[model samples]
Target: MNINKEENHVQSVVRAAHILQLVANSDHPITINQLSEETNLNRTTVWRLLETLEFLHYVERDLPTKGYQLGYAPYRLFSKNNMYLSLIRKARPLLEKLRDEINETVLLSVPKHNGTLTIDQIDAPHSIRPINLVNRLLPSHCTSNGKLLLSRLSIEEFNLILDRELEPITRFTITDPTLLQEELNWVRDHGFSLSLREWDESENGMSVEITDNRNELIGFISLLGPYQRLSKDKMLTLAPKIKSTAKEIAEKLS
Candidate 1:
């Protein structure tokens, strides 16, 4: 084919790929008109591309909404590994970099139904670092990751969860719902969370949320280490670095 024709064909393929991605990431199924508006293409061209994608099982159209959504083929291709595993894989390098920079134990965590769960961790390269709590459920009232995730909840949801007895995990743990709310409020305002020896007197954690493109909190990255060295002032100083690392991971998720 001529160079001009070949270039036009490649551009068309790129546009089609963009269309498939838009359908995959949309919050809800999207209509042809919406796709055209988003892609700056006419309805006829978008419809032709959607027809080809539907034939290939890359996307499917909804009868009721007349909208397009990702098809089973995409899930089949991605299901080789679980989503969490993929996230961890994508985040490992960033986590390692953060740990090396701060020289503190770095952990990745996501919120659970009743509490928060640690998904992955990299131990600090120091001799007397904090305990590694991998694949463990942690109390939400005191830990930095827990509070950072909790800060995403609406007031009513937060109140409902806090209605239970707030057990004190350590001498410094916050056992009062009102006081914890204040802390969570501060976390939301400051864009980070602090454990301050609440989970364990020997360890302190500083955390920031990994928010997606929509600005929704999906997970968080935290730095935990010996409280003697990772003091409140030090945590504050490292907060920006941790937040930058989390932002890098979040962009990958997007």
Candidate 2:
């Protein structure tokens, strides 16, 4: 069979790459039918391309919804890639300095789903201190990272976060959505936030936004320790330093 000029260049690999690029560029999930229409390819061809991408873990599919989304592979790739690795390396010295100054566990969190989850953490020098887990979701209504991230959200977005079931992680957890919104507003006004034994019964923390030079919300930096040791006055004293250090790190990223 004689292949036409266009057919000769219709490489499956090229088409697959184009499909993945389209999905990555979208902020929401897309369907195979949508992709087929966009690519001007038949439904069978689009499905085959989607399957290949999914097998490589670069795309995800939801059978029930019949939609596709960018998979975790891209995030894993970014996390290990040179660009973010360099950013983390540059941020470490500042994190070390902040940890030493506060004499507590200093942490950095990035927005993930409804929470600002921990991505990096440095424990207190003392051996008896509580261990803060890295890569764990901190409750949005209770932790300093959560409030600061929530404060950055628009009113509608913030409302969506509040509508979810609130977990009372501790007696102090702000389970009331109205109250949580009020606290988030206060954090916005104050430029920093404090969580005194809210997420965990014994843990207290102070958090502030890490924003780029353009004032985009990148993440948050927080100082945390046992409530028994870090008093109210001590937390107040540490807040500005945390904010400043976060700003310094954000500048490097920008």
Question: Per-prediction count of colliding residue pairs?
Answer: 0, 0
- Write the residue-wise lDDT of candidate 2 on 18-131 in tens digits: 788889776568898898878888999999888888888999987677789888888787786543366567788999988887688888777777677777788878765656
- Candidate lDDT (C-alpha), each: 0.85, 0.79
Best-matching candidate per TM-score: 1
Candidate 1 TM-score, C-alpha based: 0.67
Best by lDDT: 1
Clashing pairs in 2: none
Return the number of clashes found in candidate 1. Answer: 0
Residues 63-101, candidate 1: write the lDDT tens digits: 889899988887677667655888888999999988887
TM-scores across all candidates?
0.67, 0.65
Stretches off by above 4 angstroms in model 1 are: 1-82
Q: Which lDDT value does model 1 have at 2?
A: 23
